[model samples]
Target: MSLDTQSPGLLAEPQAVQATADGGTRLALRGDLLDFTHQPEWGAIESDAVRFREDHWLLIEDGRIVGAQPGSLAPDASWTRHDHRGRLILPGFIDTHVHSPQLDVIASHGTELLDWLNTYTFPAEKRYANLVEAETGAARFADALLAHGTTSAVVFPTVHKVSADALFAAARERGMRLITGKVLMDRHSPDGLRDEAPDFGARDCVDLIDRWHGVDRLAYAVTVRFAPTSSPGQLAMAGQLCTSMPGLYMQTHLAENRAEVKWVHELFPDARSYLDVYERAGLLNARAVFAHGIWLDDDDRALLRDSRAQIAHSPSSNLFLGSGLFNWRAADEANVRVSIATDVGGGTSLSLQRTIADAYKVQALQGERLTAWRGLHAATLGAAAGLSLNEEIGSLSEGCTADVCVWDWTQGSVAQRRHELARNLHERVFAWLTLSDERNLVTAYVRGIARYER
Candidate 1:
């Protein structure tokens, strides 16, 4: 199907057809179903309940999951069934931190945190000021996410309100659940990327929220570029936007690089730490998702836990930028919620599988292992919780949007050979996580409809 096909209604109804089994017509899954529930550690990790039947059935009617279980035959129910056997079914991956404007610069070279933004990131983002460019980029970005099995994302757009509008429009067109905001930076950014004033930025944000938020599956996030880029007035305005907009999510960078930390300390001398800058601005709260909490001190962790704010741990970006390893265990001990993310552009890959692999390696350096189940949970359910979007798009539960991904574990020669030696599900899952990239994604669905089917 072409990407420009007619956009569906907010709760679009799926087409209905008849299914047959045992010489009787009925509603059922077209093939075997594999579902994952609860991470291996169960209690230690977040609960991720899932259910899918083998050659079983899901009766989807009116764009909602009516039933999902194993049964012999039902002669009365009319439904169109999809056969997804030999494929793993899981919730669509939620990317907690990513820059939609950075789609073209994902693998650029050689600049540390702040330098990278000034050198390459900001200039690239400035292109989104044009509505046509923003729309095209938004469509491409959304397509890439769907192609890679990322069903939802908390995205950062350029400082232009049109950037957020373009992304939201594209997401709505594709029937995706996306949260995003126009980057608010009143100072310390290039001329084209900087806003006129804090109040003006706030006004634009309010406008975008009114237009986009709650329109279908989209949400609005109050995005601050970072403490260093935003003036005190701008930060306060971002805080005000958060306060005024109920259920709005807050996103910003924090303590990613050593030099960045030193700069933050120099800029906000009175604040207790880098996090304290946002905390004092009323920007820290339950719906807040801070990226790269690598340099967080003990008190910082405590404060994050106290506020119930979540962290988007971008291991790939941290490694690429030479930032220190994140202390996941320390954050865990402090009762902080953490989710894995690909801090793309700064992060090297768009593949959640690669992000999971990098996260496993990062944890290993800290003398810990992020298990296959735990990594998968972080990519899906855990990340959704971090974004405060768990109820809508996290797992394969009945009533949840049928955003699903099917993986071809043995797609490549290497994978096929590795599959031959794998003995168990866990081992196979581990191998896929470690070795699989975007090539392994066989098909991707958004809201019960196929967005990309390989």
Candidate 2:
């Protein structure tokens, strides 16, 4: 299942893959293993929701986790060992919503969502029309995600077909589990960046899907740039593709800001709410992921729950753009699937740690505390489950792909002191989450093969 046989593209770095007598790779990671078994309750962390094996050896054969043994392996063991004793070995982070071409626009000043997109995001993405620019950016962006401990992601590429092609090519070279598609926006966008014609955009998407979807670890998303930018015909075209193409994913923004919500209401007066616009287009389904979703009403949530669609909680982006706080508890109560993401560029980082730290603060502003378990789950297993890829990418359990990251218990001296003073696993993990970032990541592995190192 590994893409290691393919020639390294722009970003592949050399890493050893152990060869066993069976003519397959075998390896083990020795560390403090942790992953969520299920979704945890709100406001407080539950012990049962977590699976923690202290100082365990996570066994891997070929590209999947075979078992997790609690002690050292036999002295004559033939497997290659990457000893990360005293560190945390967990599933690689999964980012549900992020823009790949916006890597250069991160940290740019902006007034709000629309303004930000015009001033920074659009210009950066416009560059992707060039094949060289698209390939170079995609390669650097994929490398950056792994460097930040993200092994799997649902991405947003530019409106150019070349953008999605370049991104998939880069991901294939690195064996990353990546999903993206050419963005569709036929109106309200700049001349060079807009699709210009809905039918042409749909045709491009079809061609890209035939070429890339389900190849290696890559998948295609039917990316709509929100209802305002897409006409009724364009949205219908996107919906048609979803129905025709089984297992295809759909991603778009939904009520991310109050103004954006109001704009949706004005644009689609017949629709009940912002989500209703997409619903009427037949775009609501289990594979659909709407970003932000900060302003959805109870009725909208009920619709999402019924549709089995998901909301991607992008805390950093919300705070940066003055988007409202996400009602994590409310969405969960309504049985709506929710996952955490970096929403990069609009978000301040590619680091999920920053996103999770901001998530805690956002929930706190709403008079709720985000447990480390809840935050960790949202980024790891929960995100994977949202994409219906949990059985493959989100856990260290047997039969799951071996996409993993090793993290130090603490980073700076102050963070180390806090961890040392903690009285329990909960406190230690909270401190680690608050204080850690990509710098704390010792290494990241995709399919039991090391891909990034500090």
Candidate 3:
């Protein structure tokens, strides 16, 4: 179904016959249903906060969830029922920060942030200059996300505009909710991967925005790779794009590694702090997303909170690059929005489960506890809220997109025990987050279409 950004709710409802734009069958899932109700931070994640229905029916029509009910009151079978009885069905995962071009660069060894980019990232991204390569990578990347049960993502393509075009086309074909943009980098980089500002990089961004933004479920992000890579002029143009376009999202890296943070301070010497660089460019606000806020201090936290900017907490990437631990508790206490992500390439894997597992370890090393409910929320609704897309894709609420995942807790012996021993819903979620992998995914749905099944 085409989702018009102006009126996303206008997707025509299916008639009583139940059909989808792709001519795919609607989802008639019968299982142990699960979905978030509110941010876990408000209070305890008890029955009132999370919807957990035993032996329930979740109906999806025309790419939207039409109804959810317990077995006793479940509608009589009319359409095909995909029985997931004895499994856990929840909203499909969403990755708030990821590099679609970096899929091949994942697990590249022996480099920190900046050097890693120069040695591995920039070189790998240079391949996307070939549209065929970018499209091929896009196809593989799309499958990888679905295989891991991630139905939606906020992706960063290469500096090449064709990279964003290729990935956007691939995602559009699959009917996934994706936010991506061409990286605006004018300086401090390799030859083939760089683009000039004001005339070239800036204009290409506008053209891309017009070409892809609001087309189907796809949206555009005004991605300025980072302050260090982008010249003052390039950043100014990025800020202009953000201001000119009402709903355009802004994403970039920030305070990820100590050296990178120090360099940002040196590069933008007049700025107050690392976050100040973006602030100076008029790029700090609710629509902006800064990834890897690992080295942020109290002042930076306050700045982020006041500006209403969001942070994409990429635990796996932080660990892989030896960047630093993210202080989740401190960020929350500071009222800075935090969401989880798999910062692939720099991140070890694309699996949100693996990302959360690493997040648990990262927080533990810092003498902080990352609750399972909070982590799960960060991967789903919290991530969507960070991008201001929660109303459309985060939950299984009525009228929300039918992006869902069914997990088989009976996959392994350990899973079986976790299922048997989980007395509370929180415990069950915790076990799944800790032990479950992509292998446990029985099926995954994006816009009422099964994208992955095993």
Strongest candidate by TM-score: 2
Ranking by TM-score: 2, 3, 1
- Candidate 1 residue runs with Cα over 4 Å from true position: 1-55, 71-77, 198-200
Ranking by lDDT: 2, 3, 1
- Model 3: residues with Cα > 4 Å off, grouped in runs: 1-26, 42-47, 197-200
Candidate 3 lDDT, tens digit per residue, 81-109? Answer: 67778888889999999999888889998
Pick the lDDT winner. 2
Candidate 1 local lDDT, 1-454, one digit each (tens): 3333432212233333453454333333444444455433522332234333555555554444556665455324355556655655666889899988888888888888888888889889989999999998998888888777898998998999898999999899888999898998887788898878627488888888899888899889999989988988888888888887788989999999999999999999999899999988999999999999999889999989998999899999999988889988788778888888898988888899999899889989988877777777778877776676666667766676777776766677888889779886667777888988777776666776767765
Candidates' lDDT values, in order?
Answer: 0.79, 0.89, 0.84
TM-score of 3: 0.93
Provide the TM-score for each candidate, comma-separated: 0.90, 0.96, 0.93
Model 3 superposed RMSD (Cα): 5.3
Q: Judged by lDDT against the true structure, how good is candidate 3?
A: 0.84
Off by over 4 Å in 2: 1-11, 198-200
Shift in Å, residue 120, candidate 2: 1.4
